[model samples]
Target: MEPLIISTRPGVRHHQLDPVGPGLTGRVFAIPLPTTPLLTDALPYVDWSDAYAVLTPLGAPCRDPQEWAEAIFQGPALWVRALFGVRELVVRLVGIEPGGGHAFATVNWRRDEVLVGTDQRHLGFRASVLVEPGRVALSTVVQVRNRRGRGYFALVRRIHPWVVRSMLARASRTMAGPS
Candidate 1:
């Protein structure tokens, strides 16, 4: 398979970095690789830890969902308990567990698109991958439902583009073979 290249979509927030709706921000990044193989090779293994690996220097806590879940389910480290008193708290803190707490466990898959999201009292987020002719696209739509969500996105907005880019870069590297 050919390596994936990041392509830009017109009117798509990926490279454009624009708001998609009221209090909702979105970005669309293109992948040069074909859709099916890309999803097959990429989605199942993608995770916050993977994103953290690429975006860590940017100051993300980089907590692994499984580790955190384990901390809650089995036994927890003192710090883990202190940081997140309950699993629900962790979800609120982390924006929802990517890959559904397991590899691709919570994804809503379709013929050409895959959607994963979480809605909380303060925020809602939905990320999707749309397969297109000759390329694949990845996008995220985030909605801040309350004051707390607003503050969080405000702090994260500055780095959101970088995080998205790093994620695309990582995906490209992973799917296309390191470049």
Candidate 2:
């Protein structure tokens, strides 16, 4: 079977939420997702501020939050912007870890796009994702519907997990390295 790429309400059913760790090795979020246009599932990985402290793989001091955010967020954002026809993307983590021991987490992403020269008269699309780690290696599939069309809007669905996965690997190593 091919890696499932969920970008619709129905697509959510095609995938499963198989986390790598739990009951101590989980995530902690900084900011929470909204109450509308809910994601396929709930992501209790990040925190309320949309920030979290990840353990460096090398067991060194944790890198600056800004560093992590910069490395993690910007990379995927740029990827979507360049690789896909996306206008803007916002990624957030939604879980908690009071102590600090997490293998992976969810990246809630909200992407928007404008439909130009399409069947519709410049439609807009948006969606929320609960990205995690597992079989697909990435969770969260952003889906937008034209408030004016066949329930389908411009889309660049689920394109951040791979970026985040690869990026976090390197970032975790950097953070873990001894200073």
| RMSD (Å) of each candidate, 1 decimal | 13.7, 14.0
Candidate 1 lDDT, tens digit per residue, 1-179? Answer: 22222332232222234323222111223223233432333332221110111121222233333322222223423543343345446555656532233322324656556655556555555555554333334555555666766765666555545545544444433333221
Model 2: lDDT equals 0.28
Q: State the displacement of the C-alpha of residue 122, model 2, in Å, after optimal TM-score superposition.
A: 11
Model 2 regions lying over 4 Å from their true place: 1-17, 22-55, 74-155
Top lDDT model: 1
lDDT of 1 at 23: 21
C-alpha TM-scores of all predictions: 0.44, 0.32
| Top-TM-score structure, candidate number | 1
Model 1 global lDDT (CA atoms, 0 to 1): 0.39
Q: How many pairs collide in each candidate, listed in order?
A: 4, 25
Off by over 4 Å in 1: 1-15, 18-107, 177-179
Model 2: per-residue Cα lDDT over 62-152, one tens digit each: 3343444334434444553354322222111211112111112223333321111111122221223222221011122222232422222
Residue 96 of model 1 has an lDDT of 52
